[model samples]
Target: MGKTLDNVYKHQSLVYKYFLYVVSVALIVFFFPKGGKFKYEFQKGKPWQYENLYAPIDFSIHKTQQEVEEEQSTIRTNKTDYYTYSSTVVSEVRAEVSNGINTLFQTEIFTSSQRESLRNLSEEVLTDVYDHGIFQNMPQSRGTVVVKNNEAQPIAPNDYQNVELAKKAVTEYLSDANSYGTDRLSGIIRNNLKANLFYDNVLTESALNDELSKISYTRGEVDQGKLIISKGEIVENEDFKVLSSLRDEYESELWMGSNYYFILLGYTILVALVLIMLFLFLKRYRSDIFLNNNKVTFIFFNILLMVVATTLMVKHYENFVYMVPLCILPLVLKNFFDARLGLFVHVLTVLILGFVVPNSFEYIFLQIIAGIVTILTASELYKRANLFISVGQITLIYIVGYFAFHAIHEGNLDNIEWVLFGVFVLNGLLTLFAQPLIYMFEKIFGLVSDVSLLELSDTNSKLLKELSDKAPGTFHHSLQVANLAEAAANEIGANAMLVRVGALYHDIGKMENPTYFTENQITNVNPHDDLPPKESAKIIIDHVIKGIEIARKNNVPDRVIDFIRTHHGTTLVYYFFKKQQELDKDADPANFKYPGPVPFSKETAILMMSDAVEAASKSLKNPTYGIIDAFVEKIVKGQMQADQFLNANITLKEIEMVKKVLKQKLTNIYHLRVEYPE
Candidate 1:
């Protein structure tokens, strides 16, 4: 029942933490970007056709006719200058309308009622103007005017426009608009201009030109020479929607622009999410304290590395983007996180960053392949130590990765020899240099990685050395725990290294009283021998607590202290309580017990069981392997039934595995000596 309540309390304690974790991780997932490489997409057409064609080839030299003639002539133009060959352009405009309804009329440009009025006026204007079309002109003799130098200029039938003809043409068009209101005179002028521009009569063209020149000073008419409409220039309407003209609207542009933005944004999210997920998974499997902190730190470090690498790759030299995501990510992640996460994140990073890298899926696939192979090659890299081998290892991953990439992406491998040579140089030279530069990013981020583990075993480390001097008894207990926990962790497929490291300091609290604990005793005069067993048990129980206080002063981690306090639960002090029951029959059951909160964690519970089993197994004079096996199971089952192993989340299956492992370990630890004496 007590064990049940401890379990309940332990669960209650995790509720808030679980809530925080879920909410934070949910935020991450909500914002988690999905990763991808780009498919073959039509980016866009070149800015302009002439510019596009010119950019690809050099066709700038301007050749002359003489140069063209000097070359082998395919066709003859002129051998002799019999009549100086030249070109002449003549546009004969006439006011003639056979025709059709106005197609250029935009209803929005002109209102509905106004559109009807403009149509009626246009018809009336066309008819009246066509009726009184050509200007009445008297034909003059066509003769050649000869000068002193024999310059002969021809004199035509109609020399130029006269005042009478101009008045006649203007008067006739004004008569067309007499019936209608002053609706669209400019529009009328435009219609007349279009007719004249397209008409084939020279006499009618002369009249239209004469009428326009007569009103040249007036703002009502506009004449910019030969044609009213320029041949190639673009014209647009009011709403900027290019109704009947040729200009690309901004709407289509914005649509394509947004798609590009979404793709880049999505890719960024993907890189970040993959790294975060990898970090989270590793943290859960490792020891909770380090797992949580180490992963969080590494995640931030990864984001920083990616952002910086992206910025530099894009800013300084654009070609290296393909290299950074695949090569840099794996190298840096290995330097900052463990090799496992580095491998997975490297794959994801390569795939995602491919989108922003301006490469197709086929091109980026090689990057992913190379990075994964590189990380696999460097899996055993110990960066803080083994600098020489580590560099070689990184170089190998880089080289192997690069070649694999080159091979995978190289659709045409006609250059296999060259590719192989490049791979060798890349692995042997480039990676050696690149890996070190990438390592700097990991250091800058303050992320301690697996290589940083060596510092933990340092004798000068505050917690380890403090355990040795101040709390030698707890320290001894911790060593026993390290062995037991690591063996159990290994059996369960947990992080044995993490378990051992944590276990080494689990009893950091007991150092408060070096002489109080049994393990630290030099002489075998049990301290309880002088006192009532009840008082003795209280003193023994107090050591678990005293260990906590000492551990606290020394700044031992909470995970370590948890083992110290929870190792011995609130189980009754059986020896003391049973003794009091006989001597002082009325002594309260609770009063004789040591205050124990049952084991509430796997490490602590394992320690408690192992600590008892290890001591108990030493009692037999001839402790054999079979005896150790039976004793191991007995101690484990005893602890379980006593309810001391309840709240730790340690499964019975795991406990059974622990029993089996303990038997094997204790056999070697307490191996029986052969009876050699005769």
Candidate 2:
């Protein structure tokens, strides 16, 4: 049991890596829609590429979205308007007219015969107006109106009388009376006549909705085993509708039964394969990241974030899928790592998403192209303009690619969705968030980016300024080394920014004992003259340690701190060791060496070479071109013999390149003019 526990502890890192792979795969698969994919691919106005397809099951032919919208629009335009007829209003108006006529007659305004004639004419006018059904608010246009009384009845637009029409009818009836009180009688009838019909908004909307609900989404049905379309046949309007319906039905019903587990298994295997590809890529091209569990987790976390975001958008708002800023993945990765790894990871992520997004071919193509553009155009993210330009280029590509696909599908640019271009632009704007995201990742992961490197490389920074004030000679040495290392890094395709920053901070430990070092000695007095050889050696070795402490206190990232740790790389402090050996025959050599883990990357290794060569070149009395070249060669050769770069992932060819850069730079610095032959 003890041995078994020991084995588990020994392989804990491996076990953790496998656990990450499993968890990432499981989470991604869980978010995927649990529907079976359609077995065939077809596009409207394009030839069917697959074999002839037949309906596997009996299914109703569903209408296209455009077709359904047109039907609904037609229904809305021609729907019947409903109005309610008020019987109580008619009775009240009739009684009021009769009462008014009686009151007028009691005043002796009319003779008995005139009073009788007025009452008869008023009653006749009231009956005629009520029969026509005066409307409280008439319809704006002539159309069929359903009037609900005891039972709902359809009425023509002319059948309903408005107030003006009823008043005209009353006036005409009075004119026919030819009585003394015709005008007064007419006024009584017209004033008492109130509109009995009113528009019924609630009933109208309800009836309209009923009609809309009755709209048939399915036009016809296709029977099982019926040939839907032949191979190489152009998918026209009718064929496209039938094919779409079958695809929908097949996917929806395919996973409803015992086939669900199979579908889930299929999804799991595909997700696992894609993740495995990403793992293999890191292991093959970026082994440094693959070995560190934290870095590995960082990469996987980014992938999962994109997948979750895209899946949620698809599930809730499928039409807005283009709005997601997928290119941000490549942008962030390229800033943190390199362009190659960024594009690789981006492609793998898009491939996984292709399984879920609509138009698998189009989605994968657009995303891959955008990833390429990000890699090609986005550089120096510390500059704000570069990010904006890159995002604009990516958005433009999206618009152009989608336009091309749309034109291909529809055979014209007439039906292109202009709103989708806005979505693409929004996508570009969202991609601008990658810069802040990179800063946040650096903090969370304890990693440094080019932006951070650029910030640290500033000589006017607090730590560098203190180094300048306390140890001006060492600060100058650091600046020279920074220049040399940056030039060499650029020549060999290494991280020039990182190496430059590392070179600037590598000698910060010298600030602790500024006068003890030769470079800081501005006076004739030498501090080393008062100290023992062993103590001088100890002080020299302590700088690397002191630099680390100061950097951490200043909240420097671990990546930069690595430079201070391994710049000396376990090499012997030869001057003090030789002096102590002359004094004592048997002196301890272990105390004279700088404790180091050695440079383990190209950038750090370049710093080590540049730091040693640049400091040693200052001792030349009368420098010449050949002398300076040989001197640079000797220093680099000595360091190589000491195996100071044993752990660094640098090649012999790259070392030769660095030597050439250093040689040219030293000759330039010393002004070693070539001799002219007269």
Candidate 3:
């Protein structure tokens, strides 16, 4: 039991790494649609690239979506409108008319005979209006409509009199009967008349749906072992429809019953292989990131996020698949890491996504190209215009690549999908969000980005400004170091922005006691002269500790604070240590050394070289090209011999490159140009 627990504790980090890998693969595969992938790739109007395909089993050829929709639309447009004749409404209106006339005649302005004549005339008008049928409202169809009473009958548009027409007929009939009060009788008839025809919505809808249901989704059938298409044959309209139908049938039948588990197993293997490739890449080239579980988690989390988003988009909004901002993956990664890793991860992500998206080749091609553009152009993310320009370039690449694919597929520009161009534009706009996303990721993951480094590098920032005010000499020294380190980093393809930021804040602890440091001692009196050698060494060594405390108090990222701890590495303060050794032969050397964890990255390593070279060059008198070159080489070689860079992931070749850059920069600083031979 003791041995088992020991083994578990010893390999816990390895266990956690594998746990992340397993979970990422599971989540990605879980979101994938449970359908078998069709092995062949094809496009409308493009020639078949594979061998001749044959139907392995009997399947029907389905109609295209356009054909199906057109047929349904034709049915709806020509569907017959239905109207119902309500005899009950006619009966009630006629009875009301009779009662209204009798009540009006009771006013006694008319004789018995005059009353009789008005009642007969009113009856005749009502009969005429009712015989022609007063419809409830006009039908939508202008053609003849089917009217249902006890049975159905087709009625012409002219056969029916709506309420308006019925009222007009009543008015014209009583035009010559003014002596019998034409206005009074007309009002009574118009008020009593009601439309007896009403539209039958239920019957019309049923009939239309019945016609639509009769539409044949499948137009033809392919027998078993029949040739579908030959290689090099252009997939015309009919061939496209047939091929699409076969693909659907093939996938549906392939991923059913016991075959489902096998298909799932196949998917798991493919997904695992892709993720394993990513793991291998990080392990091989970026072992620093791989060993740090938090960085590994951050990378895996981004990959999973992109996969889930694309899976949901493809499942729900397949038509707008191009609208997804896939290029943001490389953009964000490039800002946080480097271009090579970003593009590598982007390509891997796109390859995995190819399993879920339709037209896998085209999607993979477009996304990989856009990702390459993203890595190449998305430099200097702290500058808002750079991101904007990068996003624009990415958008242009997407549009151009898609246009080329479309031209290949359709053999013309005439049928290019203009809406996808708008989708590409929208994708570009969403990519602009990568800047804010980087900020959020920094806060959540405790990682730093170039944008944050840019913010920290600002000379007007609170901590930097305090450093400038309290120790102007140290602040100027930091600035010079920043320029030197930045140039060296750029020369060796390291993170220049990171090295610059580190250099600017490396010596902020000198602000704690400005007078003790030689750079800030403006007057002739040296503060160190009065102090004991041991005490002076303590003060110089305490600056690194003081700088870390100040940075933590000011909420500086730990990545930047690493510079303060590692700039002098484990090297001793030679001036104070030598002074102490001369007074007593038994002085301890521990008191004079800067507490260090050593530089662990190329950026931090570059800062160490730059900080040391820039400070020592101040003591040189009458500097020249040859002298500066030798001086820089001696200082770097001494540090190298002391193993200051033993922990750093830098090559000897890179160290030499940094030395070259520092030498050239120093010569320029002192205005020491080479002399021409006469």
Candidate 4:
């Protein structure tokens, strides 16, 4: 069973999902209708009895090597006696039977006299009823039913594949048995029945023909037939589907149970906890592939979405029902992270949830395609209207799926059209409304989501107003940063709106001490003009750290706080660093630098580099496009080499792309004036 599971899977931990297998089997046992006429219901001696799965091997009956060697020696010694050639050996295992000719012998409980009588009757009937053919002289017993000289013999199920022997056995058994019993046996045989009708007919070959000819015959067309399912076959085939339905219907009820579902659920929780421990110990376990300024809230939302997805799949069935949500997560999570990471998670979830239901192929196929489609459609997240695009894609996908299913699904239309349309609507609502759902969830639960940008843009946001009132310059500077960042982010297909909103609120810390930073102060009499350079640097760098505290206390979104903390990184306060150095030749370069750590994300790095370059470009007294270009390049590279480019998803190539685009925009913003009158 374990080896069979390995063949069907790709990942290892998912082997843990066998818990579902156990739970399913247990449910079958618990829900066994005690008073019903069910078969294969864990009852002893039933073909599909549950005990078969865990039953211990019958090692007690195993033969010793010495016994096996003796058996092999007998087979070699008997080869010439049984075969046309001595070189051939037969591995045909045999069991002692009550007789040779009765294919379905009366069981061992039969009297010895009856067994002998049956054997003798079979030979007597065969001699008078059949003719031997020259081409194939006799049947060899490789188990199953075998015939020699038109007489049938029974063999065990273990060797039934010998077709030549099986055919003669069937022919001989059917010959006289058609009328063997008093006319009482003329009706169809019961499914779970034992019979020797064919064995009885061995001598009367013409009676075999007469029995078959008794049925009506039709000529021109192929005959269609209904397969008669036995009670045992029905119960075995009914299992997995029944178990799947039970899972969807009673998930919460079963999960809360003390034992049956707890084994699987508890193990899942343990795996998660172990992964958490591994995360802390390995440190690198999280694999920094697509982190951004909104790392925590982004991760929180993704994990939240992951759990929601798992629950939905567990609770629902149908190709589109559970499948749609499972596919939506990677796209949703990647809105703040990146599409690549979203695709990765989507693939992982598809493989896991693929097995949650019985017919996994259909659900998994739809899920993986829908997930990739959603990721492409929702590639960038920082917007309000992108939801519409997702909705559109979802609707289109559902339509395509509708047609595919319409042609292939085996069902009556009376039940399917409305359900299919509802699925279409449901998928659209989830995909399009995810952004709003995130917003509402964050607001209600006091959580943070990447969608928090919608709230960050509020001009009446207390921090923005405070910056505007206490330090209009800083407020205006933030607006300019918003414009610049938004434009740069858009040009390269990043989350432009998030960049704008983040830029707007990035300087909220300055509101705590507006005069300490230059952007917040207007008068030429700078605050740093009076203070020592190192002290000024502390106040300047402190805004980022302080902004984080202020944002947290005010219930600002955690994503916004992350932006504030990381935007500056540890890039040096060059002006203060230079002055402190001039004042003391031996002063360490780190003394006047912005307190430790560097920008950890593409969004923050862009903000840090752009915020510095934009402000510095504006102060260039008489800036040229070339000079602006150089300045943007210089600051970006400075931040880049400081290894400040850590968690950001921007490739070096993307940074260069960001640099080229920012230079063009800054050049226009800081355009030189013309002396038209002269």
Q: Which model scores highest in TM-score?
A: 2
Task: Give candidate 3 misplaced runs (Cα > 4 Å).
Answer: 80-92, 103-137, 143-154, 169-188, 196-214, 586-591, 651-653, 671-678
Better of 1 and 4 by lDDT: 4
lDDT of 1: 0.51
lDDT of 3 by residue, 357-433 (tens): 98898999989988988888888888889989998999999889988888877778986778998999999999888
Q: For each candidate, what TM-score against the reference?
A: 0.50, 0.94, 0.91, 0.53
By lDDT, is 1 or 3 better? 3
Give the better candidate number (2 or 4) by lDDT. 2
Summarize candidate 4's per-residue lDDT along 375-463 as a digit string, tens digits: 77774455657767776776777677656664454333333556667777776766665766556656655554455676678778787
Instruction: Please write out the lDDT profile of model 1 over residues 333-405, one tens digit for every residue.
Output: 6665456666666665455445444434544565555665566655334453343454455445545555554
- Of candidate 1, the 10-residue stretch with the lowest lDDT total is 81-90
Ordered by TM-score, highest first, the candidates read 2, 3, 4, 1
Ranking of all candidate structures by their lDDT, best first: 2, 3, 4, 1
State the RMSD for candidate 3.
Answer: 3.2
lDDT (0 to 1) per candidate: 0.51, 0.89, 0.89, 0.54
Of 2 and 3, the candidate ahead on TM-score is 2
User: How displaced is residue 2 in candidate 3, in Å?
Assistant: 2.5
Clashing pairs in 3: none
